[model samples]
Target: MTATALTMLNCHLTIPALYFRGINDMYVRHSRIQHGVGQGSFHSATVEFSATGRHRFDYVFDCGALKYAKLSPEFQYALKRVSLTKRAPGGNKAVLDLMVLSHFDADHMNGAQSLVKRYAVDRIVLPYLGVEELALIIASQADAIDKDTLKELHGLANGVGKLWKRPVTMVKTGPRKTEERVFSDDPQREPPDAERSEPPRTQEFPHPVSVVLESTGAAPGTVMLDEDNLVVGSSSAGRHDTWKLRFWNRGLHATLGEPGIWQDFERHYKRELPQTQTVVVPHHGAAPNAGARFYNPGLNHRPRVNAVISYAVRNSHGHPHPSVLADIAYAGGRLLRVTDDTRLGYQEIYLFRP
Candidate 1:
């Protein structure tokens, strides 16, 4: 169906988003952190995908770490203040349809375990890159972490799999690209290749759950946008059409051999990409993630897109990079920052109507 048709369904959809403020610390420096105070770009969003009101999807993207602490009281309080729970049918705690970890950076995944413990997460999504490969990439970057924190982050990543009994899906892009595969029970063991995968372990949820992966193709170096399935139906059980909602994560830096995020995304999913109205600003609005080329209206244009950048107040690195902000404005998109100055703490960006 056309986006115009979807606009007719806008009254039937409500998108509520919560962006958390990261604890600021002066010590660590990495490309992910534009300024001295690193940003915790934690986002929890809920999408009511079906008109039946039976197909609601909740997702958490990159649970950011609290400053100087693993489970900081401030962070916990924020979670509670937001009423983030797994309770069914009315408890404020959201029953997550999916939990996505963009990369292995501590800032990206530090609070993952806390989320698992607090919410009913049905699936976890990881990049196609292996843990070791991701770890090495972080090591090569500037402002590399010490051995202890690295170990701790790795441990926490592993813990998410162990703590959640549901499926863990890993996604990658390229010619060797594979369909989303659900991992076996053992979190430590290597999962079988996607082509040779087995059935996922059974999950008993209060509602039906579906995960959708939008990829360019099986070509080498493609981009895959992963998220919960988006369905269009006048009623929840009526004939449904599926759509995509892309969440861009700054996973790897561009190298001589690697394609840039937007480049790969454009090459593979350009037709579908433009249809996306909402996007999470990559790398907490870092410059590299929002290069001019990505937002150039003439080249890669998205008409009337809403871009959300999660930044901390008074962060060391001035985020929502000035240039990126200009580019976003140039593309005719509204820019929303998660910090208090902007829209923070349980705000509704889109509401469904009949």
Candidate 2:
């Protein structure tokens, strides 16, 4: 082995080094908080992780608004930026790893149909509703929103209708407890004909990504979401980091004025609230949805929370209520209002492993 032979070996070694760059650091590249029009909501985040190899998981929470006939600008822009498939090999149809539709409000999900058409979503997460709850949602908003949106809501209540092309997780809340159940629209997955003896068809992306609920003392478990359990902290794992997101959605029947929702939320963490880097203000910062419990950083110290309020400039509901704004300020949260206007631009938050 001479000097030339050694130099040739080093050149080959550097080729593999290019592929392993940043392979150890698992972090969120950035989250795009969409400035939706007329009280819509769209927030997406890209997480880079290493499993067998480096991979990226993209997820979106709520994409739509109260646009009458046409799709909103922000939602359109979001679609433009979102990739058509998962950021890995095989070229699967699934675009997002997870899609969370908080509730059935028109403003929050008016463009859902468009989303379904544009991207093949992997799994959708929404609150589970009974007949009464579904009826309340339809009857309550019958006159306020368009009929198409109402029809779509009706479809989701029954079985996610056209959107049923993908998998779904329905989160049901009980007395101070929450349960999640998985439902599949694909007959191969959950065959409609139970009597059939044939095996299910093979899936391009067979294994779906799961939300792991974590607690202080307990190790997180991958949720099949088919059992009775209380999942407080939902997290997605990277190679060296685990990112957590806590969603607080007061059920349609829950009283908004009081703090029961917050109480139930806190109880999950054993009364010790963890440090939340970002908090999406619920209901576009509607007054009823805002409570002091949401702002508390608790014993675990944290930097300024990013309080994101997605609403329109002149919304009929007057969202981002003065009190909600004030409460966020008092809690030392960095108020980041996301409206239809481009003034605030895309509020991108970068997350790194602690």
Question: TM-scores, in order shown?
Answer: 0.58, 0.64
In the range 96-125, model 2's lDDT, one tens digit per residue, is 666667666666666766776666676666
lDDT per residue, candidate 1, 1-354, as tens digits? Answer: 122111100000111121111111201110111111235646555544433223445666566544553433434544554333344532555676667666656666666776776777766656645466546756663253555545543543454332244456544433414333222212133312431233322232323434433221111111243322222111222212222333323335432112454354444333445445555565555554543322333222555666656666655656667876877787787766665333233244443222
Clashing pairs in 2: none
How many residue pairs clash in each candidate at the backbone level?
A: 14, 0
Best by TM-score: 2
- Error in Å for residue 324 of model 1: 2.1
TM-score of 1: 0.58
- Candidates' C-alpha lDDT: 0.42, 0.47
